[model samples]
Target: MTSNDLGDFLRARRARLRPGDVGLASYGARRVAGLRREEVAVLAGMNSDYYARLEQGRERSPSPQILDSISSALRMDDEAREHLFRLAGTVPEGVRPRPRETVGSALRQLLDGYPNAPAFVLNPATDFLASNALADALFSPFESVDNLARMTFLDPAARSFFTRWERAAEAVVAALRHAAGLDAHYRNLHDLVGSLAGESEEFAALWSSHTVYGKTRDGKELLHPDVGPLSLTFQTFDVRGASGQQLVVYQAEPDSPSAQALALLGSLHATRHQGSATER
Candidate 1:
């Protein structure tokens, strides 16, 4: 990892955009790839020399306002914008550093309340901090589901488990990329990305794209050995006290076949737990 990769990141993002992408008319022969330096400066409402300095790593401390402007000019998403702020050595306003990773007892109880819903908590690095029984059942097919990105990219079962494997893979990689950028100094995350990049070609290709995003409110289609196929919608909520942890809940449509499957799975899980207690 370079001590200052900000220049490389900025240049890559800039090269990804075209003159027409930022509402600039494309006329005459243009030699430069993507938007020119002057074009970006004009769009960002900053001086070309200053912007060039930023790209050259000569200007290390850009104000939040300027970073925000550049992000806007580049059509960056929320995750990309956050990454830009981090590279500038400043946190964006209203964004706080992630707190310690701890899922409170109350939150665990809340997960219990959702017996029909598959719920789990994940740290910023996608580590499985905690999970409900249904969530356990849902992910039971995987040999290991400790890290979501690993399971998605490294596990062969993931191909079948996630019906839309490509989409799931992309989302997982993007989220991990987002986290890694924000906490570049995190050794574990660096190791995780390195492992994935080395082990999975798909992961390596996507990682180079530098796409970043948090989990979104989207439905997932899954295939379970016992239940066959399931369609579930998932929502992610930030844990009140835990900074970088999020509670993700998966729910099936009411009275639908997927819901019925979940109910059956819940019953099976409960029976197994009761039997285990009885044996003890």
Candidate 2:
């Protein structure tokens, strides 16, 4: 375990939050940014000194109840709350198994069936283990699409590809944070974080905020090179019997412009694949 990692995470998170964010009034000039240490204590229903101790690394273990209270005070989502527990070296019982990196043959076949939609499988660390042709075309601009988080933060094309790039970046970082908390010993995740932190100041700032989240059904807007702008809905599903693997599928509403764009992207992918096969 990295010494003081918990303290560092707590301090960073605290620094990013504001008094007004937690329903507290800002009455006077404040020297520091975010909620003061005492304010967090008050909101969390804990002693100020004790909360300080936790942030200062003097307090190592906090009860689940206390952690829950603190998580609430911090306005943490479910994933972020779980990350807090993990940082304290006490994950709540019955946590699901961490997803593995491998994508099974059955899953690959399922993805192949989605000719129009873009679909792929990601491990807990956001590694793209397998993707269908349409999915490949969707992310074709990236020099490498090995890791979604890395691509979002480090790839130049990401800014254009994701119409709302800043929001997309935050979501990616939060998802990575949740994954890191789930498996701190994941070497690949550690390396990926280290690399992104070193290379991108934006990524570093977001990572320090210690936010946590997971992908679910959501709308995404992207600028595709071949098909122009696309507005699509994406849904992520847990690959049953495959720990730490999630299958993400992207689709557009019927008869929408996005649907037409998707069709064009599919045609382009098919043409390219056919050309390559003929050459071989």
Q: Pick the candidate with the highest lDDT.
A: 2
lDDT (10s digit) by residue, model 1, range 34-132: 788888999999999999999898999999899999999999988899888887779643466644667789998999998889999998778898999
* Model 2: CA > 4 A from native: 21-28, 92-98
| Clashes (candidate 1) | 0
Model 1 weakest lDDT span, ten residues long: 91-100
Clashing pairs in 1: none
lDDT (tens digit, per residue) of candidate 2 on 1-280: 2477787777777877887788899778888888888999999999999999999899999999989999889887777777889989796534756557788799999999998899999987789999999999999889998999889988899999999999999998888888788888777788888888999999998887776788798999999888899999999998889987889999999999999998998898889989999999
RMSD of 2: 2.2
lDDT score for residue 113 of model 1: 90
True lDDT of residue 166, candidate 1: 92
lDDT for model 1, on a 0 to 1 scale? 0.85
Q: Give the Cα lDDT of each candidate.
A: 0.85, 0.87
TM-score of each: 0.86, 0.92
* C-alpha lDDT (0 to 100) for residue 203 of candidate 1: 90
Clash number for every model? 0, 2
Candidate 1 deviates by what RMSD?
3.0
